[model samples]
Target: MSKSKQELLGYQSHLIQDNLTYFKPTRTSTTVTFAEEIRSSLQEPKKSISPKFFYDENGSKLFDEICTLPEYYPYNSETEILQSIEKKLLPYLSNEFHLVELGSGSSVKTRLLIDVLFKSQKHLQYFPIDISEILDQSAKSLCMDYENLKVTGVVDTYEKGLDFIEHYDDKPNLITFLGSSFGNLDHNEGMKFLQRINTLMKSDDLFLIGLDLKKDHEVLHNAYNDSQKTTAKFNLNVLKRINEELGADFNLENFEHHAVYDEQKGRIEMYLRSLSEQSITIPKSDLSITLSKDELIHTENSHKFSISQIESYLKESNFEKLEMWFDSRKYFALVLGKKI
Candidate 1:
């Protein structure tokens, strides 16, 4: 894997273990069957898939590629914003704080924040939770070089609850859910998620969230569609996953990837459109689904936000926005909120 600028800093030292236990997901055939059933049902009329399923080991890697594509503005825009504001953001962080990150994907962009924090604080503990085991291992190994950093990696989704973190001794924690991963949820669901985090925090704890700003439709569309075709492959990989896990017959070549910004919904919709009428069977679920020509199966949504809207959401979720930072173009934002 390619190391970002912050990753180089994390590797300069040696691995430090905080004696944190590794959490792994219990893989069962039922899980695969459930996924197939959900996919089949979503195709009937209104189509959708839980964006959570898009981060299997291969999906994680594909997404990393999508970030680097020239057409993908979200990754670069957010990275630029973080790198530019990290210096200022450090002053708001305390020296004794433990950094907990939600949906800590490969923890690539997070290295930018962690590196800056380690530089100023000297000795800070870290916890990164994600559902992808591959990403968890990748992040853990990368952080190994930071001798003073102790990592507690959890392989679970944020929606599943944070019971995994209960064993740890309580302290002033700085929790972050960066990369606008929260955008995967609808407005109501997103607020509920924030409320859940508010329950997890003490009065003095901090929450830093990254959000992609609303921008030109063309720019947003290109970010998801990508001229390099990486995003397309990433979108279609779901079917490949189905074939491998559930004994589904899905010809990857039979479908084309489509992503478009839905202005009314303020979200990017990803779908796999069938080039021709096709029938797919999932042996594990003992289910069959038929697709008409040009039919689409929705895959994911990336919702953009405005600063005012986010602040309102924070208030509703029992959090108060403390500070916010943005890039020169104002393409992205990193907002820090305190539990109220």
Candidate 2:
């Protein structure tokens, strides 16, 4: 970060409330309400659940497990960069800024930044935006862990979280979207998402985004399809959610978890395949669906990006790329961008 950008991020203003609160959803965070989404996705032409549905309480716990697994390298890769760059990044942030994180599941990786900021600054406000109530638990934990920080939990998606920040808060902000969750969207979707982010940012506001770097097909394939089968369990947990919430009779044993890398797409795809043709019913949604033995329901897509692609994305999003740091092997990237 340059001295000029630092001046931009060193935002100052008075808060009307000046306290922690939940921000209401201003837009469709869960595309088509939960019940409707399950029904819509299960409709014939394409049978799939948005990956966003994969983060229910149980699913979130499973994900935390998946991150620790040896086969999954994203967590470690991002953490490595944070640890290595923490010292270098301290001077760029303001003395008292709001640290907002999107999809801040567990927020284990965020501790690296938290440590750095606490040492250099007198006070910090932490706003962790997530779609789960788990953010409450995480926020509570962070409050206990840090003394100079005031932790606020924003139980909303990234889109609405930005609305809350733009409308309610006016402190210099450093927003973080970690865990390479940005890779969940495709190119066009990513561009639009970034544009929305750019729209909310102040001149000095900064965004630190984690991006998974493109690697070989085999390496990418194994990351999602771990030897421990934890990733598989994580994927199948989506059905587990439907069964629990929608009263759907989805036999866990009948659906197997599968993930593959699409070299052409530069992404890793995860699916739940039916073991045998079976009909299932979701009483809540008033929906019934039959699946062929080998039919697959796409659950998630993790898009990988090259450094050049990241630069283009930042430029198109109306953000000027400031700096990018990668892990030793360059398997992942943490990019710092300033709003233009």
Candidate 3:
């Protein structure tokens, strides 16, 4: 049901053994890469590490917690859209196509789409790409529950998994990039990723993307910085990761997590700020870094989009918007796109 460490540059699978295929990159990065990234990110000007690092086992659990919090709206809003728009999205799917999911964590929301597809087609092939291996009986459970469904799990980055599917398989696909995961990337990086999807997929191939829509500043801020501090624990868990893996001296109690809504950038920025001046030594990277009082290490930027902005992204990424659905409150958007 759950596998940890599926974040970018995080998975280390060597091979896929069975029909429950996992995406193991042809080349593997050394363990030192983690330390290298930490060292580089903590350098002078901009102290930062990717939000992807927040998906390690513990971080993933914390995120699961954040998703269920009352203040968080994206999960519930996107689920509402998927529930309402399934029939509309179904007409585009072909009987022989593969339903590919990028960053398919838990595959919980995926059932809505698959249910609709099964009504028309007897059998279906699914490629649920994530950075984590299936921990529970996901493959067994899905196959048993859906008699005609077969799943191939990919434990790799989105790019690597998409490349594998494009090169090795020719099945027309209805790819779902749910969860607004793309928003974690900077605007340019997001476009580049979309551009890759445009290139690998055919003109008729379907693309579904879920994005958090720009809303009240307080709402966005509360979503990331909940009253219960679940998100705070989630953000600081990254430091716990470094302490455990890199032999780094990071006192969790000395740092506090906070989030801010960046109005101009249309993003929610999460950071871990040092409470006081302190030095941390990471033996793996052979690096020692000192923090000033209240110094912040930027952890993530979750960008929200307006409808107009979404249209611009769709056009620039070579996708034509086919159908768009939003929650009753218009807090989230799920758009079905056609590759142009």
Give TM-scores for every candidate, taking all chains together and pairing residue i with residue i. 0.87, 0.90, 0.91
Residues 98-132 of candidate 2: C-alpha lDDT, one tens digit per residue:
78888764466777888877776788877777766
lDDT of each: 0.74, 0.81, 0.81
Residue pairs whose backbone atoms clash in candidate 1: 15-144
For residues 206-270, what per-residue lDDT tens digits would candidate 3 score against the true structure?
Answer: 88888989999988878887899999999999999999999999999999998999899889888
For residue 105, model 2's alpha carbon misses the true position, in angstroms, by 2.8
Candidate 3 or 1, higher TM-score = 3
TM-score of 3: 0.91
**Candidate 2 lDDT (Cα, 0 to 1):** 0.81
* Per-residue C-alpha lDDT of model 1 across residues 200-273, encoded as one tens digit per residue: 77776788888888999888878887777888888888888778887889999999998888899998988899
Model 2 TM-score, all chains together:
0.90
